[model samples]
Target chain A: GESVGLHLPTLSVQEGDNSIINCAYSNSASDYFIWYKQESGKGPQFIIDIRSNMDKRQGQRVTVLLNKTVKHLSLQIAATQPGDSAVYFCAEGRDSNYQLIWGAGTKLIIKP
Target chain B: EADIYQTPRYLVIGTGKKITLECSQTMGHDKMYWYQQDPGMELHLIHYSYGVNSTEKGDLSSESTVSRIRTEHFPLTLESARPSHTSQYLCASSDFMGSRETQYFGPGTRLLVL
Candidate 1:
């Protein structure tokens, strides 16, 4: 499925429950990927990243799963907290340009 | 915990005005990038530089230009601001040359052109 080709506005999710954000990249040669969390009034903070060689990678509280066959990427957060409410972005490495291609962010919300 | 910094966190300028957003890093990174983002949206790469005196335009067609005079400094300039140019500009740096390198970002400069 073509996932990351379009640019959208926002995303909303609840707190406490697990949160899953999805991204679909356009390029197939993109070998590396990263997830970033941006809080209000702050710059993006690195979450986790995965290379083409791996299908899944886990961090302190986040996990990144990559499906190269479909060019799909996902970020999963356990026990989402209010402080976790922010915009999450997915980025990829451009094989030809040596730059990262970014996806439209998914805004995670923590509904009290 | 990134040492990158962007000045004039917020700016409101009139159309046709010339503006420059400054970005600097103390991490001594070799790769730097400039991205234009609307509030909470995808980041469009505007420009990038691999090292001093090296720069290249990005995927998005941008009216802004950037310069890399020093390894740690990559500033973007809009010759003439317009309403369409109103957006948040973010600066990032990376250690380039590593197979797995992370890009650290600055707080960003929010520009509102009226």
Candidate 2:
């Protein structure tokens, strides 16, 4: 479930710099992984989650890195702010009864 | 103020009519969700409920339909509207009990089935 091509790809950080967003997932049993923050009209707010035996996880300023061999997943934003711009999603799951499975969103622009 | 509410934030119905999209939560969550995005796409789960009247059906095949009597309400109905059913319709709630439960979203409900 990964094929979205219109490329809204853009990430220009600067406010205080430190923003990285990258994702590549295709389920390898997808234990659990989440990071979402969509702002334009809102409705996507959980911003940090990691499972799959844990590869990395942090919160508050955000940070979630998990690489199950290469299924890759990353989201690090510490300090950047303009309210943190918008669109940022990367989710996968196979836990808590399953529900998440999203990624094709990465638009965090805040270069002031 | 734990909240999650969605309503007619914006609508423009005209095709076949009959639309209902309202979701509420005062945080007494018992798991509830419904998602469908279309602008930048990716986020498709059509329905879910793990409490009250319990309902389930998600994975994009949705003509719309959901209900959960009272656990803070979970409504989504389309019965008719079309035009591919416009877009944006999100409502989430979580805390399916114990162990790290996260998912609290609302502030979405933008339909335009014209």
Candidate 3:
């Protein structure tokens, strides 16, 4: 089955430094991608998203880079903070589809 | 930031017990979804609804059922919960208008069947 997966199960970053999380998808027909953050004991929260037509999108302190040719996506967060400690998931979907293919998730840990 | 909410953040019940997980969204989105996830695992779609009085099964097969009586309310019911049914259930909604496909999620309900 086509699925989205993370490059690593966990990533550690120093406070005040930048952090990057990588994801790989197997479906080429997917036209939409999104990143979500889930805190402990909480549901997933929307972080950012990008369409296949665009290669990159930026938020307040986050940026999502999509590489359609390689089926890879990456999320970069600047100035990592303790509040940023959570599990991050990447999901892919088609523009006309209602459901998304979710990745297993990668835990982000902040070190002071 | 989203107005979606879920009741009974955590629950511990015995086997063969009937339970209902409540979910509601004030956004009045036309699309709603239910997903089951284990600790540190990926999400599995259990059910979803297109709108009021409209429902459909998701990719994963489950012993649970769902109902969408209004645009803001969607609930999931389990006839008889087993230990294997223990997991975190999440509810989400999205507006079908435009090219926005982002889903806003509720807090989620964690069930522990013993």
Tell me the tens digit of each residue's lDDT in model 1 across B1-114: 999999989999999999999999999998999998997788888999999999999878879899999998899999999999988899999874456767899999999999
By the lDDT metric, which is better: model 1 or model 2?
1
lDDT of 3 by residue, A4-108 (tens): 999999999999999999999999888789999999988899899888899999999999999989999999999999999999999998877788899999999
Candidate No. with top lDDT: 3
Candidate 3 TM-score versus the reference: 0.97
Clashes of 2: 0
Among these predictions, the greatest DockQ belongs to: 3
lDDT of 1 by residue, A1-112 (tens): 3236323345465667888888888777777888989998888888888888899999988899998888788888998889898899998875455577777888888887
Give me the candidate number with maximum TM-score. Answer: 3
TM-score of chain A by itself in each prediction:
0.86, 0.33, 0.98
* Root-mean-square deviation of every model: 2.4, 14.5, 1.1
DockQ ranking from best candidate downward = 3, 1, 2
TM-score of each: 0.92, 0.33, 0.97
lDDT per residue for candidate 2 within A18-50, as digits (tens), equals 998888886687677778788898888877778
Candidate 3 structure lDDT: 0.93
Per-residue alpha-carbon lDDT of candidate 2 for residues B9-111, written as tens digits (9 for 90 to 100) = 8999898989899999998888888998987567888899988999999878878899899999999998899898898998889874233457888989889
Look at candidate 1 and tell me the lDDT of residue A108.
Answer: 80
CAPRI grade of model 3? medium
